[model samples]
Target: DQIFSSALTAALMVGLAALLCGAVLYPVVVHLSADNEQKAREVLDSHISMMEALGRAIAKRDSDTGAHNYRVAWIAAGIAEKMGIEGNTMQALIAGSFLHDVGKIGIPDAILLKPGKLDDTEMAIMRTHVDQGKDIVIGAGWLDGAQDVVAGHHEKWNGSGYPARLQGEAIALSARIFAVADVFDALCSKRPYKEPMSFEASMAILEKDTGSHFDPGVMAVFKPMARAIYDQLADCDEEATRKLLQDRVKHHFEQ
Candidate 1:
């Protein structure tokens, strides 16, 4: 009887201990989950902040009206997402979109922020950002996946764009899509060199570029989303722009 009772007591104690452990650990598990989510948000937020800082740097360098890069990046990401990109590829697109001009950081100020058309020599120096950007991000070990964006965003479809001049299907899709968004935003937004173009005029320009300057298929993907894209462009802010930029660079080349 004693032995049986002792065995039973041990079993009961084990069960009680397990129950206590579960009860105690449940809240800890919940806390950890919450903490993990918060951390993820912070990480995302940090990336956005970094993107914004970069944009501001560009604006400072060029005496920009401010927030154009942010807004353009927002529009670019919208177009990309609407086209069905997701996951890391989407993120890379976002990051690359913001950093596409990062190479400008290396361009001579005379060419980079020039309010007038660049002379051939200046243009030559200006285009080096593509390679310069590639080198910059490639050297930055912490910015994983940024190298492709830094290097390839300048590539154009039909092999007309600068730097590598990679031909169709060879150009990074993000760059192809970005070429449209970036140029469109520039056309529509006020700049030091020229007054902003009317929305109608901008559309006409994009339409004119069609197959030559922009990707025909991506342009089609963008056409239906114009209104949504416009809404997003209007809604953008520095904070939002930063987020869009990060997602763009992160997603661009993967899909």
Candidate 2:
């Protein structure tokens, strides 16, 4: 009887110890998990900040406000959202739109900042920005989605574009959407080369080039929202535009 009682006691003690250890470890596990999540968020935030800084640097280098990218991103996201584009696709569109000009960073100021039309040689160099931008984006693991826009934004619908000359559907969808947003913003924003066009006139230009310069399908979705998006960003300063774009990016990527 004594031997049996000792064995029973030993088993009960072992079981109790295990239960107590688990109870103690549960909170620790939860705390560690929370810490890891926070660290991940911090890392992601850092990466995004770096990208934004690089994009804005390009904008400043070209003597344009970073607002150009902000407006383009907003327009792209709006069109994408209306088309029910969600998940990684939408995130890529937003990110790629902002970094689309990253390749221009490689161009010399003499060629990039020229006020007049680029000669054939200069134009050739300028065209290489697309490939350069693609290479830059491809090097960064976090910027994988930006490759399409960075590589193909200058491509035309009729196969008359630069770098690759990819025609029609051969071009990436993100780049197609970006082309529309880019031209829209460029026309609406005043530049040293020309005055800003009215929304109607801008639409006319976009409509005229449908199926030639832009993807007809993407243009169809963007037509309705074009005026509204332009109006919203028309008066926004650079800081406000950046804040708006950052919020939209965070909503899509962080969630």
Candidate 3:
């Protein structure tokens, strides 16, 4: 009888010790998890800020207000979400969209800001921006993932684009997805050289290009959302557009 009582006390003592340990460790574990999450968020924000700063620098060099980068990124994110792209690929798409034209920083102002059509020589120099952009991103460890769109955004579905001329699925999917967003934003946004094309007219042009200049599947996904995206972002000021894009970036990167 005494042995059984001692065994019961020992078992109760062990259980009580376990409960004490858990009671002490639970808050510590929660604190560590929360700390790690905050650290991760800070890292993501820093990366995003770096991307935005680089994008703005390129935009300023090209005589833009930086709305162009924000708009394209936002538009690309929308299309990617609709197409069921998420996680890292989605993050890369957003980064690439913002920094796609970053190579333009290397172009001569004479060619980059040309008021008229680029002569063949000037055009060739302009085309080199893709390579310049590729080099820039490849050298930056944080931005290496953006290389796909940076290098291939100019590539066409047909084998006609410059720098690489990657055709069809040979073009990275992120690049293909961004191609539509870039051109659509350019068409719908006014430039010093031309008026903004109407949404209907822009869609008409995109439809005309179809499989030749864009991925058919990507185009199809973008078609339905084009109107709403255009309406929301086409005329937004820099502040409004940046805020909208920030929300998207946060959603993608934080998740």
Candidate 4:
């Protein structure tokens, strides 16, 4: 009886220990998972914040539309996805659409802010921004995905564009998408040199240039979203727009 009692007690102790471990382990595991999720959320927020700061910086660089960059990036990514470009292509769309005109950082204030039309000499200087943009993207460590867009975005579907003057398939796919995004933003955005053209007029312009200025497949995608995208652009405040242009231009030349 004594021997049997001792054996039963040992068995009871072992079972109780196992139950304690199971109970304690679960809360620890749950706590760790919750901490990990919080950390991930913070990291995601940081990346978005950085991108917004970059958008503001780029606005300072060219004195053009800064938020317009963000809006176009969103629109172009949506259109690119619909057209069957996936994965890294979508990422490139985001990066390229945001930094497509980064080379304008190198342009002189004269051409960038001229109140009138660019003469031939000014236009030539203006075009140099394409090559300058290519160099900037290549040199910058953070903008690895943006170089192709900066360099090739100006290239035409019909081989009439600057820099490499690449035509059709020779141009990077992101650039092709950017051609539509950039033109749409430019036509719709109020600029120092030109008033914002009405949407009806802009559509007429885009339609006329179709195969010559933009990729056919990309245009097919942009057509349906054009109205919606303009609405997004319209949400921007003009005072903020003017301040961004004025401040950014002043800062760039000061540097």
Best by TM-score: 3
lDDT for predicted candidate 1 compared with the true structure: 0.71
Query: Sort by TM-score, best first: what order?
Result: 3, 2, 1, 4
Model 1: runs farther than 4 Å from truth?
1-19, 139-142, 227-255
**Cα-based TM-score, every candidate:** 0.79, 0.89, 0.93, 0.72
Model 3: lDDT equals: 0.90
Clashing pairs in 3: none
Task: Extract clashing residue pairs from model 4.
Answer: none
Candidate 1 weakest ten by summed lDDT: 246-255
Q: Pick the candidate with the highest lDDT.
A: 3
Query: What lDDT tens digits, residue by residue, belong to model 1 across residues 1-255?
Result: 999999999999999999999999999999999999888767766766676577567667766624766676667778877888767766666666666777677777777767777888888888787887677666553354556556766666677777778878787777777778887788877655678777778888888888887889988988777756665565566667666555655445322
lDDT of 2 by residue, 147-202 (tens): 98889889999999978889999999888989999999999999888999999999
The alpha-carbon lDDT assigned to residue 209 of candidate 2 equals 97
lDDT of 4 by residue, 113-139 (tens): 787889999999999978876776674
Model 4 TM-score (2 dp) = 0.72
Q: After superposition, how far is residue 99 of candidate 4 from its true place, in Å?
A: 1.6
Rate residue 166 of model 2 by lDDT: 94
Residue 244 C-alpha lDDT in model 2: 84
